[model samples]
Target: MSKRTIDYYTKIGILTPERSESNYRFYGEDSIETLHLVSQCKEQNMPLAEIKEKISLYYTSSVEKEKLLKYAQVLSKRMEHLEAELKEIKPLLDALNEEEQKSIINRMSPQSMALAQSLIILFN
Candidate 1:
């Protein structure tokens, strides 16, 4: 990874790479794992504020397993909701041909339609 990428992660508090004697940043396994987690969270369109809160919770808690279980519960609920939405939306999505889908998407409001587009990309 480039210095800029490392710096970006540091700025977001997702990583804290240690500096060597010559001031060269070196990321450890923990930092690399954190970067992967943060990237996955972003890819899932999780809010940065929520990610930050979760990261802080992870660090400050003694019962790490319990905290992770709670986080899993939250993620499961989100997955359930998305699945429900997909069940409802799939027929509509399937009914349209490619051009029609594009046209429908263009007419939809951004907030209402973005998740559908993301789900399409994710599932495809």
Candidate 2:
């Protein structure tokens, strides 16, 4: 709803709202949906070039349903891998008392924390 939101989408080439006679930008359903998809992909930390390629593939494919199904399959596999890692880690996490958890946090690097967050999100 804000100019910054529109500007971000425009910068990504995900949305191109048309200007009205009064120079107000008007976003249609397609643009809004594209923006939503772009935001979701970004939240997952998917690379922009990969996102662009996927978007183009979605639009240009004659067998869109098949392509979408394939993409879903890939995502499913990723989710499965994440789930397995979480399963392996959950017991260890649960076994740690509060003090241990604090100690682990104190010793963990930022990169390790980020990786853990990414793994959790992927599974989630």
In order, candidate lDDTs are: 0.76, 0.75
**Model 2 lDDT per residue over 87-119, tens place:** 798789879999998898778788767877787
Which residue pairs come into collision in candidate 1? Answer: none
Once model 2 is optimally superposed onto the true structure by TM-score, how far is the C-alpha of residue 68 displaced, in angstroms? 8.1
- Pairs in steric clash, model 2: none
Candidate 1 displacement at residue 30 in angstroms: 1.2
TM-score of the candidate numbered 1?
0.51
Model 2 scores worst on lDDT over the 10 consecutive residues at 52-61
TM-score of every prediction relative to native: 0.51, 0.46
The digit string of per-residue lDDT tens for model 1 on 33-121 reads: 77677777787788776676577666674757776788788777876788678878789888989999889778978865877667667
